[model samples]
Target: MTDISEVFGFIKDFGFPVVLSWFLLVRMENKLAGLTEVIGELSCNIAAMRGEIPKR
Candidate 1:
């Protein structure tokens, strides 16, 4: 049917970018988590240096 073909065509046109964006977002989430952890560690270190908190 023409409607079925049209649906497939629409999916073909838009699906790749949607899938790719999802994949990239998953990868970026991991990197952002690592970055957040590093930032927290850095903050702790700075606090220790300032004598606001005891060093571990």
Candidate 2:
């Protein structure tokens, strides 16, 4: 059996918006770092390949 009081009780026990925002921020930072790593790897690969192959 659920009541309005119980709903509020659960919300009081668990802060919703604060937790949600923190979760999103953490994931966004991770994704941004991953993208940076990929870009750096690609840049290095291009430079390496360019050096190995002579210009035509």
Q: TM-score each candidate.
A: 0.91, 0.52
lDDT of 1 by residue, 1-56 (tens): 57998999988999999999999999999999999999999999999999999999
The prediction achieving the highest lDDT against the true structure is 1
CA displacement after TM-score superposition, residue 55 of candidate 2 (Å): 16
- Computed on alpha carbons, the lDDT of every model, listed in order, comes to 0.97, 0.85
- Give the winner by TM-score: 1
Model 1 lDDT on a 0 to 1 scale = 0.97
